[model samples]
Target: MSQALEQVVAELRNSLGTIGEIVGISESATPRFELFHAPNSICSQKVRAVLAHHNIPYRSHQLNIFEGQTYLPANVRLRLMGCIALGGGLVTEHTGSTSVSMGGCDPAVVPTLVDWETGQVLVDSKRICFYIDQTAADGAALRPAHLQNAIDAEVAFVDNMPNYQMLAGKPPGEDHRPESRRKGNGVGFAMSKVERCDHYLAQFADDADLVRGYSAKRSKELNAAQQLFTPEAMRAAYDKAEAGCNHLENKLKSGDDWVVGDNVTMADLYWGVELLRMKNMAVESFWANGAKPAVAAFVDKVESIPAIRASVIEWPGAMY
Candidate 1:
């Protein structure tokens, strides 16, 4: 094993205070399904909902990301530093003749799926969710045949919130909080868990270069986000959210409690999580302040589902 991979394995083993568990999981099961994830990870939560929705069973390996576990060399080599094919497969092997660079990208972001039955190891929440929906015969169809386009559109909008970058510190947002306020409260508490990643990672002196680069980039992002709270930025955020709310309102105006049609679909799931995030950030005032009564009712309906509420990681203010 490479030093980085070895380090990750060691950390994984150490965190659980056990030996052979990681390797054992890899080796013991024939046609096994495994999911590597973190509890509070949004993507992870999304995948879990899909899995729960379908009643698909898999082994869960919840990584303690706050302890620098994800930065371990193995995780980088396996998860992030790999070639992800559009449909499903993740190829991490490096060819001697070609240079494959995945610098500064943490692939261990969570909710990685390994389906031993199909010999498929997939990363990315959307892809995994798609895989589950496509492969599983049971469960309510998340992507209904008639509503596919609408579902995709809703997922696109929810996942591509530019203003989300203002709060999340990234385009495809990851949780961002300051290390000093890890234990403190008031606002942005959700970010506290994700922010400690850099500090924990710095203890690995061998990865100093990578650590320094990440720290600098994080600082830059935080500074940029500070500016995103400006009146103009707030207006932009409000407008964007209003646009989404309007779309949802029109969809629900038909008297369907869900986004696309009478039944819950991927669109519902995507917006369910997105709405929860907005609520967490106190941005759901767009609904509460009487701007979109339809949307408000729609969100309430989505949240009332046992699968959505139980499967999704409930953030503060997420529940009704």
Candidate 2:
């Protein structure tokens, strides 16, 4: 971490004991990285599941995204630094919950990973998970070379779905999430994201990096605001996720237990979280429910995996 960023993380952690705690014990003399994540974020869940599945160790700092902890100036600065490192620019569009899913760097969000010794700040859950998977010694690769192409396809498939947007806005006729869990209970923050970013934008107007970061985030929210909860937009989001599940159902009908190959791979890891997210939202009506026994069974099997279970199913912020 940069000297300035180091102080910021230190300050954030100092008060984290109340709202955040580390998830795993460090396995090496030197820690690999520190994760700034949120317990309920689908993206964060994917990363946590990867760490658990591979038995990798990390310092986990949980953020409450709804409360805009991720929009804090320090966090914004860190995310923007990550954006620049990846050659990404200001956000002018938002088709997905996070920019990473839409082929851009995220200047605002949780689950940012910062390396310990190198200070390499990694954003995007898929990149972070693949980083941990590929860098491990023998017998630890999640997307092994021979399976890289296939695994990547599966991962990208999940990334293509509007996972976050599906929850952000619910179609009254189609949404099945429990009443208390709908709209405001857990996923309404996007409605106020622009205003929230503005609050911090004022605090760091002079800090060039902070100004750019806040502005990028505000732009992201502004772009998404236009269609956040319109009935058409909400239904479209649901259809997208359902169509994704249907595609998986067709793949599984071939009698394979996993998305690709015979054994569990990174593909399974990504789909497990995706399925879990839909399940929690009660949004599995047509594709993964009783009518689609194959897909339903697959969802059950993946969620039961010990590692995935701990990482997401029992996460503190998980909705029923």
Candidate 3:
């Protein structure tokens, strides 16, 4: 092993105690949870928010998506094992790694939860959030059937709309263009070169019709985003998003602090992270720069929650 890998393993051994027995290899069937996540990914943020809300303690394996380090080669996993060993071994019985698959409709996405005990791997943030809500031990409960449905709908809506907007902004042309053409700016530029290459290969395959359709869909979404992003456009999208927020605010306005019924649920955790993004992106500005009392109060209410605060706090040099 490389020096770095050795160091990581040494660290894991120190932290985990007997758990380090599973580092190199072990027959024990203890289920451990490993989360592979990118530091700035929205979906990753959402998952982390849920984890925190549930107060579920698990080891984190940071993947530098910006650096193209999402896939775990055998060697890298070995290094991770080293870290887990140093962390004093796995503490949970349901041991396995989870990630959000950002590969678009593929089964190999991130935000996935792996149950080593059952050898089950689950993808999809909504599903993962629900699982955590149902299984977590000493944390807040996700209850009230109606409230869960509302929260799920809101999360799904918020999640899908941004992708549509992002897709809408691409340059128009044949889908078989060079990688440079496909990767324009913003999130695309920041994506690891490996991810960009994979995206090009996956999305711009031999099928012209498929490529065209994908591009067209993206163009529509980008156009919508453009129209919705301007000072005037911002107002429209903000109004829509705020309606979602207002749904939560109204709930909170009834003297309850959380977005869902009363206590913080997966819904609040999911929305809290998104709102943090919006606040940072100045999305609320379209609706009076968040100066409006209702919006400010709403932001204040979510931000005040301890779990939300921990999950969405600004990282150093995060604003680019």
Most accurate candidate by TM-score: 2
lDDT of 3 at 286: 28
lDDT of 1 by residue, 1-320 (tens): 24553454455546545442231223354325567776655666677778767766666666664565554444543463222333233223211101112112234346567665655556667767888899878747899777888787777666555433334332122223334322432224223433643554566546654454344334433443345444565456557766777777777787765777778888788778767666655556668868788888777887786657766644322222
In order, candidate lDDTs are: 0.56, 0.75, 0.47
Query: Number of the top candidate by lDDT?
Result: 2
- Compared with the true structure, what per-residue lDDT tens digits does model 2 show for residues 1-320? 47876876776676454424456776664467788998888888888888887776777788877677887666776787677776656566677655375746667787888887688888878888898786666486778788789889889888878765666666558457777556452234564888887887787778888777777777767767775556677778777777888888888897776888778888998988888888877767855437778888888799788778888887777554
Every candidate's CA RMSD:
8.3, 2.5, 12.1
Worst 10 residues of 1 by lDDT: 94-103
Residues 1-320 of candidate 3 have per-residue lDDT tens digits of: 25554453344334333232121122444434445445566666677677666666555545554444433232133333332333332211100112112222221124444444443444456665677677767545664466767677656655643422222223222322234334543333323322443464475578453343333324432333334334443334435555766655555566655555666666666666666666655455523554455546666667877666655574332222
User: Which residue runs does candidate 2 get wrong by more than 4 Å?
Assistant: 14-20, 27-30, 97-103, 172-174, 183-188
- Deviation from native of the Cα of residue 220 in model 2, angstroms: 1.0
lDDT of 2 at 89: 64
Between candidates 2 and 3, the TM-score winner: 2
Question: What's the true lDDT of residue 232 in model 2?
Answer: 71
Cα RMSD for candidate 2?
Answer: 2.5
Clashing pairs in 2: none
lDDT score, residue 226, model 2? 71
